[model samples]
Structure formats: C-alpha cells, structure tokens
Target: MSKDYRSFFGLSGPAFNKQIPAEAIYRYPHLEELHYYLAAAVADGAVAVVTGPVGAGKSTALRAFLTNLDPLRYVVIYVGYTSSDRALFREVAHGLGLSPSYLKGDLLNQLHGAIEHAWLGKQRSTLLVVDDAHLLADSLLTELRQMLNFQMDSATPLGLLLVGQPTLAARLKESQHEALSQRTLIRYTLAGLSRSETSEYGRAHMLAVDGDPDVFTAEAVDLAFQQAKGIPREIGNLCVYALIRAAWQEVRSVDRKVMGEVIQAQKGP
Candidate 1:
C-alpha cells in the first residue's frame, strides 16, 4: 500500500497547497517594487495599474498589499472580472455596503457619495481594486476615468487600482482610453521567477509547511524549475505531483527520474 505523502516525507503539513497566505507569498524584486509603488499610490489616492501574464504573481502581489493595509484607516473594495459597466458600478456600491442601482449615472453618484462619506466625513481612505480589467470593455474603461474625475479632479479621494494581463496595458494605451491613461499614476508589469528564484521558492514553501528543505533533490528541483518556466503556480503543481510520485514508490526524496515521469504524465499523449 502507498503511504500518505505528508507522512512519507515527514512533513508537518502539505507543502504546496493551492492557497498561500498573502503575507507568506514569495516576493521577488519586481513584486517588492510593486509593493512600494502601491503603498505610495494608496497614500496619494492615485490610480495604479499592474499587468502580467498568467501565474506571474500579479494577483498575489495585490493581495499582499491589501493584507498590509490598515483596516481601521482604509476601506478596500475589490472587484474581479468586471463584465459590464453596470456590473462594475454594482460591485463598487455593494462593496461599500450600499444598495446598487442599474442606472450608470445613479451608480456613479452613489459611489461618489460613498467615497466622500468614507474620506472627508470619516477621515478614512477608500481603495478600489479591479482584477481582470482586460476583460472590461473600452466604454467601461472610460467609466473608470469618469470616476476619478469626481470632486472636479481637484483632490483624489478614491484610490483606483487596476490589475490584469499584459493585454490590459495595451488596451489602456489605445486612444479611446487616453484620458484614463494620463490619470494613471503608476504602472507595473510582473514577471515570473528566475531559475534560482524558482528553486528558492520550492524551499520556502517546504519550510513554510515544516517539511525538510532537501525533500527534493537538486536534479529534481532543476527539472521542476525548467518545466514550470519559472511560474510559481506551475512550480507548485509540479513539485506536489513529484512528491506524490516519490511517496507512491516509498521513497524519501524526489530525483530527476521521478521528475521526468511527472513531467511526462503532465504532457499526456
């Protein structure tokens, strides 16, 4: 009978679970810089956009930033995959604990009042973060620009954060979004980890779960890194399956041969 992987590896817990706490997420140079820029933008109530390919840690970075925000002083509204103009406004209103309106103009007015109440009245700041903004239509992007124009654009009471893939940046550059483009205070693009960083990433997760650092051999680690192409999600998935393979064989460590088998299985015929 095959032993359980965690028991076989002497691990205290699962090393490569899908969910990693925001604070515990691995941060490289680019993510560190993104955090700094996001902090500054939040303080200024400015607009910031973060773009990257899938599994590049864009959402992870944003989660880390939001986790660090002081709940007493800042109100964070997070909307994912904004499909329509009304959906966007509806999300904002719902996030603020207010009734949502189907009318765009009414929604805007309601959002403005919510921001004003949160900021000027309560001395708190509001941050609205929209993920998968690339899916939003150009008209919806224009609506974002109009939201920033509240209070005559004299003072920024609402902080806007847009997160999406590389295509989002391309969309923003188009002439239709020119005004919104100009309003963007900070722009950042996240990249995947390098080979060395990928190895470190594996070790970090192992340690986080109280597993042995040398659970994966050097050759196995290299294979995982290469196959994952430095994407953290891919790395985690590869490593987890490699561990399972080792455990099934009643082995203590995953080596190159086991990694090769896992990779082959992943790329089925």
Candidate 2:
C-alpha cells in the first residue's frame, strides 16, 4: 500500500491520479475548446504556442493531447529542453530513432529524410512538440525559422508546437526573434482554475484515487483551493497535506479545520 498521498498520487504533485493517469486526460471548463484549438492548429500546419504559470498544466495539457491522437495517424515527437540547434537536432534525431553518427555530413539531409519517412510511410501527420520553449537559445530559435524550410513539396505542412511557461510569450515578443515569433500561428495561455473548477479538480483526483469524493468537504476544498490559488500543483499539495493530517486524526474525510491545520503547519516557521 502507498504510504502517503505523495505515493498514492504521483510525486511531482498533481501531474495525474492513479487511474488513467497515463491516458489522454481532460479537465473541465473550456478544456474542450482548448483541445479544439490545438487540433486545429496542428491540422492547419501551424505551430501552436502554449504558455502558463509554473503550475498551470501546460506540460500536462500537451501530453494529454498527444496521447489522444492515434500514433499511426500522428507521428508525434516530444522534445523538452534548451535553445541549442545541435541539441534540437539531437533530440529530433533521437525521437526519429536516427543514429547520431549521421551528423558527420549533410545531417540536415538525414533529418529531412527521417521526417519524410515518418510522414509518408505511415501516411500520418507528423507533429513536433517542444516543451520549455522559453529557454530556446536565440540560435536555436533562428534554427526553427530555417527548419520551417523543410516541408515536403506537398500541401500538408509540418506541425510544430512550443509549450512553456508564461515567460515564453514575453521571450517571443522580444525584437530579435520576431521572425521566429511571427511563425507561431496559434497561441494559448492556460488560465488557472476557477472556484468551481477547483472543487471539481479536487473531487476528480479523489475519485481517481478510488477514494470517496466526499472525503473532502466543500469548505475544506474551498480553503485548500484558496491556499492553492487555483494552481493544479498547489491544489494537489494542499490536498495531500490535508490527507496526511486527516490520517493522523484517524479520520476518513478531511474537514475545513483539518485542512486549515495542515496549511498552517506548512507555513509555520
């Protein structure tokens, strides 16, 4: 049995719950709209820019979205990290299962071939998802501008996505990267959860854990959500702490008082 809420849930805080945690997960209130927009962006052969605060679920949204698409229907490449062209090349190559030795000469040709092979063989759409795009170095950012030149002569354009924190938007707005910025055909900044979403969010995780949704009282959820400030990570942390507190008290459910005590304990010097 899992020792605590951290073990019960995933350690990174609220990435997902135990059940269907690895599946294509969706959340309430505008999630469908966001889904629609991302799908449309990729279909339109345009790069989508997703930005959000620290705990805003940018990574989660992209991962969930990628899982929703059929692998045969969409060859997706997930790259998380820096702003280096060489690094980008390595990541793209790694995703494509290309050998690193191919970079000796005409490496771009190899990658273009890889892209073509991935696209034509399966007859599926090819998507490149780049996470933490704000850290992209200026050189690599420019490389994207150049890499856009790599589409097959066919009408279908390659799909590229940049997911990162809100600062990514500001970074794109910088004057130097204007050329690269202009290519971002779509942009979405995930908003934090609302009060209703917060309660549902808590209940959803509890349900995912196969625990009673009523394990957390409405007042308890409200206080936890307030302390969480609607951030998914924060909500998960507060809920876990509340659960530990309730556990110590031999209570199956958490009340506002128990939740408050946990919060206070966390903030105590």
Candidate 3:
C-alpha cells in the first residue's frame, strides 16, 4: 500500500479540504471586506454583487460570512445553480420549507409571500445567495430584479446576493440589465493573496492540520506563491502536491526543488 503523506508530515487531518471549518479559514483582508459588504447588504435588505476570478475564494468568503450570521435573525437561502427559472424558484421555495409550484407565476407568488412572512412576521431577514450567477440568462436576471420588487419598490423585504466570476459584474453593466444593476447597493471584487499573505495562508493550513508550518521551506513557499499566482485554491493544491512529492522522496521538509518538480509534473502534456 502507498504511504500516507499526512502520516509522513504529521498531519492530524486532511489539509486544504473544502470541509475545513469556518474558524480555521485564513481571514485575508479581502475576505473581511466581503464580510463587511455582505453585512451592509443584509442590514439594508438590498442587493450586493461579489465577483472574482476562479480560485479567488469568493465562495469560501461567502460561506464563512453566512456561518456567523444569527439564525434567529436571518433566514439564509443558498442557490448553487441557476440553470432555469423554475429550478431557481424551486431551490428558494425548498429553502423556505415550502413546496415548489409548477407554474412560474405561482412560484413567484409563493416566494414573495414566504420572504415577506419571514421579514414581517418572524422578524427574520431573508438572504438569497445565488452562486455561479454569471450563468444566469438575461430573462432569469429580470426575474431576480422582480424578486426585489416589494411594497411598490419602497421597501426591500429580501436581501439578494449575486456571486460569480468577474464577467457577472460586466454583464450587469450592460444596458439590458440596467434595472437590476441599479438596485445593487454594494459591489466588490475579490483579489488574490499577496506574496506574504500567500505564505501565511500555506502555513495557516499546515498549522490547522497539526503539521509543522515550516515543513515548507521559505524558498518552497516563495515558489508556490509565484506558481499559484497568489490564488488560495491553487496555492493549497500546490502545497498538498509538494508535500506528497517530499514524502515520496523521503525528505522531511519541502524545498524549492520539490516544489519545482511538482509544478513541472502539474504542467505535463
């Protein structure tokens, strides 16, 4: 049987796994900014748009933000996909513990009633977070715009958060989406980590797993920051791969040479 890298590195658990607890996630400055924007949006019961490049940790930041919200004061509904109008409504309905309707109009009415009830009756704010929102068609986006139309547009009973790639922001700027775009109160783009932040991120993950932070030499960490372009997901993957390479070579610490080999293998034809 192959040797376990975690054992070789003295890791108590998997490093860089998606299942990592929110408290264990490294709080980059950008993530803190996102949390602030989200908090403002929820407070105003308005719309917010967060966009970033792939592996920029947009979803991770959102997850951490939602985890800390007071459940008694907020009803969080997450929609991961927006393939169709009905599917979108269905997901929201399910989140509110209501059966989805077959007709589009009925579904809209159902959602409006449920959201309003949560806000007015229970005094709980309803936050609808749509991930991968860049894939939403213009018609579907119009549906989202209508969702925010409450009390003759004078009051906002629901908070809508659109999270996706940078293209989602550009798409919102188009003339066809002006109505929805105008309603967005907060907008922020997530940036990747800086050189120092990248090193800290790697070391933080190592410490979270009960492994030695210095298991990766300074040179190795530098190469990782460069090779991963400061993206957290990419940096994590590179670090894990380098650890495996170091274990295979019977090295106690990952050096520049080990990271280089891992990078080369990753770029293979």
Candidate 4:
C-alpha cells in the first residue's frame, strides 16, 4: 500500500451502525415539517415530498431522521432510485424481502398485503422513502401517487416520502399532475447552511473524525463556506481534502495555503 493510503484510512470516521455526531443528530428547522410529515406517514400514512438543491444535505438529513425511528415499530423501505414504476415496485418489494421474481403488479399487491399483515398483527407501520426521486418517470410517480389509495377512509395506510432535487418539485407542479401535487400533505426544501451554522458544521465534522477543529482558522472556514456555498457534503469533501493535503506536507494544522490548493484541485483544468 502507498504511504498516502496508509495515512488516509487511519482515522476512525463513523461507519454504519456507528455513532452519530451531535451536529449531525440535530435536524435543521426547515426540514422539521418534513420530520412531522414522516412521523404522520408512519402513523396515519401521508404522502410527503422533500426537495432541495444539490449538496444541500437532503439525503443525509433523511437518513438521520429515518435512523431515529424504532426498528421494531417501523418497517422502513429506503429506495435510493426508481427509474420506472416497475423498477420502483421491484425495489420496494425487494427491500421488504419479498420474493424477487414476482410480477410487478403482484409485487405491489404483495407489498400492500405485507404491510397490512404487519399493521394488523403487530401494529408495525411501513414507511416508503424514495431518495433521488427525480430520476423516476412520470408514470412511475403516478403509480406511487395512486398507492395512497391503499388507505382507509379514516387515514392513509401507505406512507410515502419522496426525497429529491428541486426539479422534482417542478415536475409535481406541471399542469398534467394536479392530483399528485394536491395529495402532498407536507412539502419541504432543504436550504444551505447559514453562516454560523456552516462554521459550526465544519468544526463538528472535524471533531467527528478526531481532527482538530482549531486546524481551520475561522477565516479558512469562512472562505470554505463562501466557496462551497454552505453545502454540507461539499464542506466535508473540502475539509477532508484540505486536511489530507496539510497532513501530506506534515503540517499539524490547515492554513490558508492548504485550503487554496485543495480548492484549486477541486476546480482543476
């Protein structure tokens, strides 16, 4: 292995089933309506949509929210993609561990049956969460919107949460899809971090990785926030690259020079 590789994988970043950082644990206010909608979806089954600009932390926030739910109480189906209605059904059914070879229509029926069985037998509610939902076709979305029909007159039983980029909101607003748009119980857009929030977020990512928060001077963080425009993933990528660049030169702290190099590398020719 290269010396660079030796240094890179040495740190203990939180992997799956590992710890959640305090900063990452707290879901920001803009997404709180989303949280409420998700809770209602699991309890009463509502259709919810969460949209945001690229790198705005929508996926991460959704993961954090879903992680907090009681596993025994909730059956969560996380679909990272659904290129078509058939694909969506297959993916959801697969996540729920249904037989993989069933027909698409049969899969849908089976999914509904499985959820109903759990709801009746154990009071376990199912939450269907689709992330990066923009790639989904209109027909597929229609099938998804119609799935709420599984509900009784009293409440929606098929809870749906769609997380996607801002384009998904535009798609919903098209004149052709009024019914789908109107059915959304709660809609949220994740905005980029605020100035103070950006600084604190950078510090937290550093602390999470056992790196020194003081490694980034306040000025460096300000520059990063300005350049990366307060996107959490960009903040993380930039900080990691900057720290690694610093470490390569055997520097204990990240200075302006190291940050500039990392930024330039990211913006390379």
- Model 3 C-alpha lDDT per residue in residues 139-254, reported as the tens digit of each score: 99999998888873555678999999999999999999999999999999999999989888887888888999888888998898998889889999999999988888888999
In model 3, the number of clashes is 0
Q: What is the TM-score of each predicted model, taking all chains together?
A: 0.94, 0.88, 0.96, 0.86
What's the lDDT of the predicted structure labeled candidate 1? 0.86
For model 4, residues 1-269, the per-residue Cα lDDT tens digits are 22351254344563111245534443556556667766775675667888988888787778778877898878889887856777778777787788755577677778888877777777777888988888788887888877767655554446888889999999999977788888887788888887777777766665566645577777777778888897877876787777767767877666778888888888998
Report the error of model 1 at residue 122, Å: 2.0
lDDT of each: 0.86, 0.74, 0.89, 0.74
Which candidate gets the maximum lDDT versus the true structure? 3
| Winning candidate number (TM-score) | 3
Answer with 1 or 2, whichever has the higher TM-score. Answer: 1
Could you tell me the lDDT of residue 208 within candidate 2? 63
* Candidate 2, residue 126: lDDT: 68
Q: Across residues 1-269, which tens digit of lDDT does each residue of candidate 1 receive?
A: 88889888878788776467776677777778999999999999989999988887777778888999998789999998867888878988999999987677888898899888887777788899999998988888888888887663465678899999899999999998999899899999888888878877888788878788788888988888888888888998899999999999988888999999999999998
Pairs that collide in candidate 1 are none
RMSD of 1: 1.7
Which of candidates 1 and 2 is the stronger one according to lDDT?
A: 1
Name the weakest run of 10 consecutive residues (lDDT summed) in model 4: 14-23
